[model samples]
Target chain A: MPINYYIILSLTLFVIGIVGVLTRRNTIIVFMCIEIMLNAVNLLLVAFSKMHHINQVATNPTAGTEAQLFVFFIMVVAAAEVSVGLAIIVMLFRNTHSIDVNFLNRLKH
Target chain B: MTIIQILFWLLSALVLLSAIMVVINRHPVYSVIWLIITFFGISGHYILLNAQFLAVVNIIVYAGAIMVLFLFVIMLMNLNKDMEPQKSKWLKLVGAIACGCLLLVLIAALKDIDINNQIAETNTGNIGLIENLGTVLFTKYVIPFEISSILFLSAMIGAVVIGKKD
Candidate 1:
């Protein structure tokens, strides 16, 4: 598997996620799309990490392990984001009775 | 092409398809289901890459925990109905155009990257294993790990605060 295959796969998923985030009306769906984008990045990171590991002969034999570490941190942040984001979404639904993001503008008043 | 290549293509296709389904599905429940399939497909890719630990962790964290959280929120909100009013056609069109442009730009930029010189093989050492990763995580990446704990604590407090009735 050439590295380009992974790159293209991740890019396509990322593009799909971007489309969802931009066009979706529901806040939950938008948030899910962001998760998709994050997963796409994770896939890319792991792929590059594997590539680096294959090429490593002398420099830091454990090259690319850092990328996995980064992925771990990303998951951590994402977990935290999900908690706060869903809570905020729940609060919005409670107040507005609708999860449509357009209603968020009403908050400015 | 070997079995790994075939598996790679199959899993990538499944992931992309399910992800698109996740975006196009009107119901949040259906979206959650498709996202789970997408996570499974990505985990298959991780296994193919020999990152067994990540594959297991991805399943445990993403497919198991985060998705259940999403489904719970959707059920709790009683948003089962197709209540999400459609966005304007213009907005959808603009979004599609922007996404297409972004994809093209990304592909163009990727073409310049010199990554094909390396051979893709199952030669990844102990890097993706549990023992090695744990050693690195506790020794080198310990500070960031501790910080993530703090982040989780703050997020928990914020959830409790925002969720409390006013």
Candidate 2:
């Protein structure tokens, strides 16, 4: 498959994520959108890894291995992020009784 | 077009549609469901690209574990109702337009890149296999791997601290 197609597809997915983050009032939905954006970047990274592999397979058999490992680490970090973020969201809801992003405008409460 | 090409397009359509649905759905539960679909579609793309390890990991981590956590939180918070207040029409329009413009700019900037002729190796790459990746992970990337474990530990402790009621 052409790398351009993957790039365009990933870009569209990322844009959709941005739209979700910008338009949604629900904090959980916004967090989900962030996950979507992360997935889009992961897909692009894997695609690029394959592209690099195809180009350099002659000299290096494991040409694109680093990118895939990077994706693995990304998943690790995202998991940790989600745990902490959701805990914060739950705490916010416990105090504010709502999960609206607008409710969080003021840092001083 | 080859079978691989057809499969790629199909997966791409599935991913994009489900991602949009994740944004459009009013109920957070439905959004979570749609996000799972989106993750599955991306996993299909990974399989197509022959990154078997990442595909399996994506499904297990994103679709299975992470999404379950999301659902648990949503249900615990009793957020199944459509209680999300709608943004103003103008604000939504502006957001959509901004995203569209960003997409256009990115496409324009990347359309004529030098990688136009390059192709991603699909259905035939040993580098994506688990054995090779495991060796590289334990050898070249061992330190970062250990650091990520510490990161997970800190995150766990932070969650516990923040989530504990006063």
Candidate 3:
């Protein structure tokens, strides 16, 4: 229930996501890891927002809502990124017949 | 510990475990499934934070829409386990080490910030409600909202252009 618990949990999730991005060979899995990272941030933001709201209830009623708003925008941006990213990945797969991101370096030629 | 604390710990554990499975699972489909579980666990966390609106939206966007999109891409690609070319063991080792270092650094940095005992309850009232969110979003955050729409428009166009066969 403490803020630290939420922070630590989200941080662990974020690190897991980083590991996935670094280690995964498949482009799609890498993208999934990026999503994981985004979700981790969202979790942390909501927790902080709640904590601030509880503390500042009398002073500012809407203090915490902004973080939730930010989360909404993040989701929107994520959706957009996924659309474009998946399209690019699909295009790459079509051309190279492999979704391995390391295979993408050869595109320079 | 109260019921809320118990629920929080359970959900966090579920999230962490499924997230690990997502990364280590050999099959991409299984990875996707585990990722959905992770998203669900996050949604549970949002609910525990008394942000019911966010909890619902998290499920709708991440688990429902985005995950389905991922599954469609995976199935369309006809990806199989054997087709997944493995990265070198050295690369995996390096990744694990780097991630471990980062986690340790973050934990160390955060150790000093002493948070008091303020447990989040289930009902935090109107701030998280749809009406409040909508009022602030349309009035104060209107510009960013419009910009996000434009971003979506461009992404749509880009997807169509790149996805089209040459």
Candidate 4:
């Protein structure tokens, strides 16, 4: 398969994630959408890394693979972020007994 | 189709399908389960890209650690499927239109970009062994790398403070 295939796939996934985040009232699903966007970008970065490696455009694969390293760090941070985010959401649910953002009316001025 | 290509397609399909389930499923437990599958599929993609270290880290961090926390929270709160509220039709339409436009723009912009028609020439001999990864992590990018750990430590502290009893 062409590497562009992965790019297009990544684009599609990103859009789906955007749609989810825009429409979903549930905080957990919204968090999942954010994760989706992160993964889509990781795929795109890896695709570009392969492109750079294949065309011999970059002299050092090590440098080119920096994108992959960046992605690894992103994943680590994402894991950390999601755990905390989920905890906060759970805490909110314990008090409010609901997950919908629209009904979070107590914060309204 | 050759074996490797076929495997790639299969893994991609699994990932995409599980991701869809994560969005649409009503039960939070089911949704979390689907997310685990999604993590597994992403790890498979990492392997296909010849990043064995990345694949392992993905599984360890996401599937093993992060997901355990997700499940813990899900169970701690005892979320019910019936508690999930329905979004309005208008919001759905707005989201779909926004996403559709975004997808169209991305596809249009990428039309002229061709990449990796040929497989990358990788030194599969070493294939980024752990020693190589460690060398780069500690030597060249050591400062930023260590700084990121400090960042993570701060995040962990913040999470603890935020999550303390009210």
Please report how far candidate 3 places residue B157 from its true position, in Å: 0.9
Instruction: Score residue B29 of candidate 3 by CA lDDT.
Output: 93
At residue A38, candidate 1 shows an lDDT of: 98
Q: Which residue ranges in model 3 land beyond 4 Å of their true spot?
A: A107-109, B114-123
- The alpha-carbon deviation from the true structure for residue A69 of candidate 3, after best TM-score superposition, in angstroms, is 0.3
Better of 1 and 2 by DockQ: 2
TM-score, cand. 2: 0.98
Off by more than 4 A, model 2: none
Instruction: Write the number of the candidate with greater lDDT, choosing between 2 and 4.
Output: 2
**lDDT-better candidate, 1 vs 2:** 2
Worst 10 residues of 3 chain B by lDDT: B116-125
Q: Quote the true-contact fraction of every model.
A: 0.74, 0.91, 0.76, 0.45
Q: Candidate 2 lDDT, tens digit per residue, B58-151?
A: 9999999899999999987998565788899999999999999999999999999999989998999898899999999999899999999999
Ranking of all predicted structures according to lDDT, beginning with the best and ending with the worst: 2, 1, 3, 4
Q: For residues A41-108, what per-residue lDDT tens digits would candidate 1 score against the true structure?
A: 99999888988887884777788889888898898899899989999999989988999888789758
Alpha-carbon lDDT of model 4? 0.75
Top candidate by TM-score:
2
TM-score of each: 0.95, 0.98, 0.95, 0.90
lDDT of 1 by residue, B16-41 (tens): 99999999899999999999999999
Q: Candidates' lDDT values, in order?
A: 0.89, 0.95, 0.89, 0.75
